[model samples]
Target: MSLISLLIALGAERHLSSPIWQFNFYYQHYLRLFNRISWINSSKSSASDNDGETATSSVIANTLFIAIPVVACYLIIEALDNSLLYLIVSTLVLIVCFGCIQTRNCYKQYLLAAFRGEPTTCELHHLQLLQDKNLMDMGFGQSLVWLNYRYFIAIMIFFVLFGAPGALAYRLLTKITEQNNTAVESDDIGSDLNKDVAADIQRSELPHAHNQAISVFSQKILFWLDWLPVRAVAFCYMLVGHFSKAMPVWLDDVFNIEKLPHVLLVDVAEASEDFMIEQGDCTAEPCLLVRLAKRTLLLCLAVIALLILTGVLS
Candidate 1:
């Protein structure tokens, strides 16, 4: 059932490439409502409490916000109590949860700009992407590689191991962090839908100080949540790419918690594939890295299918 869901979801993702299908449609509305309720309920305590108390309250509210949907998802799946129904619902959730449509579109535009020799446009797109993903400077190819892991591969890994609920939890956490990423254009990628969402969120928002607890907790918890899967995907990179080149870098950072997941993936992915990055040009390298990441994804799925075939997983 899991393997079947994976295949179906991937197929649907390619065909159903509309903004209406994106999870942000529901997330934006859910968050705005939650924010209002949380603010209203905590108005007095927040006014009376110290900074520590307010921060603690913020963390609690954020956790409850993330937990509500995840718990509901789990309960719904359990209540179904039938295999076909489980597969159908999980497949639907996976389709909605999967993909980085905005990022993917922006990447295509970036490539077109790069190919057209419009360095200025490429630079602007690059900066916006870095801002959206909250990443530091890395090669364009490396950025694509890491985003592939973050937006698609990581979610798939969690889905296989835990279920749709796990995938939804991870994605929900990301959306919250991405929401608080920047005050103005915090949209994960520049979707008009997301722009409107960000505008609404900011206008009704409290001060940055109020959201500090959520930002801190979400980043810290997201790191731990991503730790295992990041390594898991890195191993796949090693298997599908140059094992000899990637293995040492993988070991060096395997146990290092301080290294962010994207940084680790970028480093390992760079070693896994060979390419020459021109001084200012970001064209060919991104294609290579994206291809390497795709191969790793296929290898990851193959292993999952093998395990299921051997009755090691169900």
Candidate 2:
């Protein structure tokens, strides 16, 4: 299934402008509906002095929402290879039917507003009117909305159907090995040696040196994982924005032009910076790290979906 998702994602990447309008439309619709409902439920419960119960109910409702999508995804996976043509045709029809309604100018305006860093107070207020709590609850609702729509539901479906143990294993192994290596390196450099000797050892074992190694390993994994989907993201950005604007930023931020083939150092540096920024600005609306994480997540979901589809078809 993972392989199938990867292939589909890669194939999609080749034709970056392929209209996923339908898919995006339906997805956004469900997301908005789920979020609105969750917000209302949470607000009503919270206002009635049953905060705990409300929270619990909200969680359960969220769980149900999540479950439905996961089941739908699994069904899609089951139908993949057995009905390749049917799957393709169905997906296309879905895209077209949903896309027509979802591809409205108003939605594009909202997207542009997001990109341009405009406040979504109006949208938040509208959602709030449907409930009692304010925008903060709405924000939480949105997070819960994507938690199912984008991450757990999408990725789980792909991983379960495709057996993407390679990707999973690679991520796990690299993380574990990197942590062990860092501990060892830190221990080696922190011993009671003379200042000059310690400096020499530290030079040989720069703090970032271990990080660099881990970064390299991660990059390698992404290299394998990104064979198809990275381009898809790049293309999506291009279609929404302009090629020059989107591609250059993506190349510099995601591809790491300065580091190029060496993805680890760049990733580490970016990750570190992201952490610092998030910690510094706790109240900022969706910190840079969150945005990057979301993009990575979306990319992963797309890949996983493709893999599941491929596995079923094959």
Candidate 3:
């Protein structure tokens, strides 16, 4: 069932871009409903309330807001058992969890713009596709690596661990973080960005405490959820990319809590490309990076296939 659902989702990506395949649309609905019930925005008007109490309340409220619906959906799916409806419902849930159709299309367009030697145009296209304008500084290739890790690899890891419910939960957690961060940034209207989002990517900067405006509790939870799966992704880069170079970076940063996930991913991806440029005209670097990411995805699928063959994945 995992393989079938993955194949169906990938097939939809390859051959279709219909509104029915828009995961963001469905995800937004879920987010809206969750936000309405979340205590994340609750005021601390009570004089007796302290910081610890407020933080704890926010965490519990956010957790329950997202958890109840996901648990209910998982129970319904489980109750279907071996019915044909099980496959259909599970497939649909998996598809929505996989990602939005429009996002992938926008990424493809960004690549096309990159290939045309239009750096400015590429940046514009990328800004349109990604929620953070600061991410554009990573270049198209590195940005692709970051998004692929977040929206694809990480989500799949949770799916394998806890099925469809896990997948939805991970994506929702990401959405909630982004939404909260965006809201915080908007409120601090006078906050200067330093115009170094791209420059910071180049440095592979540490994940600073000051930059976090989102709930620290939720961020910690996401970091724990991402820890193992991200290592798996880095290992995939080593296997399919430059093994010697990629391995050291992977080993060094695998335990480093300060390093951001996307920065680590982009570092390995940048090193993994087997570019064949003769005169250093590396116009194909962005596309090649994307290809390497796809290869890594295929490698992961192959391993899952092997596990299934050995009667281990079922």
Candidate 4:
């Protein structure tokens, strides 16, 4: 079921951009309903009554928000066990969680503009991609690589280990953190962002402190959650890319937890493939990194299929 769903989701992500596949419709609906609940409103009011939210409330709210959907998904899948409907519903969820059409479109447009020698238009699409995911801190190639890990690799690992609910949980947490990160500068986050967000929330200087604290709580959880998967991604880069060049960097940071996930990923990726080149070169750095990411994805899927065949995975 895992391998089947993976193949379906990946194929749909690549070939289909239809409105029916858009995840935002359901996502926004859930947000709207969740926000209108009486207790949710009361919780928010109390958290702001003191002009700040306690770490406890933020943790509870964030945990509940993710936990509710995850628990519900698990229940639904369990109830539909061993049926064709199970596969269909699970694949639909996975498809929605897998990729962003807008990001891909922006990248393609940027490349087109670059080839046409339109620097201004290239910059426009580049900014759109960065702003969409709060990835402005890195180079264009680096951002592309990071988004691949976020949208596909990380979600894939979680789904394989814990099924569709795991994927949904990771996606929801990512959405929270991504939105929080839009207003946060890289300098403000340093290497550790959780502490920084917590401090800012306590001071109540930042608008939306209640929401920011909730997001920061979720961010801390993501840091721990990303610990192993980020390293796994780096190991994949070593295999599918320049193994000799990527090995040391992977080994060095493989156990290091303080570095930002995207930073570590981009570092190994940048080393795995040489991105430095003269202007008007045939292959752009983003193109190379994106290709490396694709190879890594294929390699991962192959490994999963092999595991299923070997009776190591069910």
Error of 3 at 133 (Å): 8.3
lDDT of each: 0.80, 0.37, 0.65, 0.77
Clashing pairs in 3: 137-198
RMSD of each: 2.8, 21.0, 8.2, 7.2
Q: Report the lDDT tens digits of candidate 4 across residue range 49-124.
A: 7654655666776788779989999999999957689889889899988887767877888888888888778777
* Highest-TM-score candidate: 1
Q: Which order, best to worst by lDDT?
A: 1, 4, 3, 2
**C-alpha positional error of residue 134 in candidate 4 after TM-score superposition, expressed in Å:** 2.2
Better candidate number, 1 or 2, judged by TM-score: 1
lDDT of 2 by residue, 1-314 (tens): 23444445434433433334323333333434554554644553453364335434433443454455545554655566765654554343322221112112223444455556554643543243223211123332233222222223333333443433222332233223233232222111223322434343243332343334434544454355543333444344344333454455455555443333223322322332223334323223333423543454465556555655666433
Name model 2 segments beyond 4 Å from true.
Answer: 1-5, 13-24, 32-49, 79-314
lDDT: which candidate is best? 1
Predict model 2's lDDT versus the native: 0.37
TM for every model, in the order presented, reads 0.90, 0.30, 0.77, 0.87
lDDT of 3 at 1: 74
- Residue 20's lDDT within candidate 4 is 54
Error of 1 at 293 (Å): 0.7
Deviating ranges (above 4 Å) for candidate 1: 38-49, 183-200
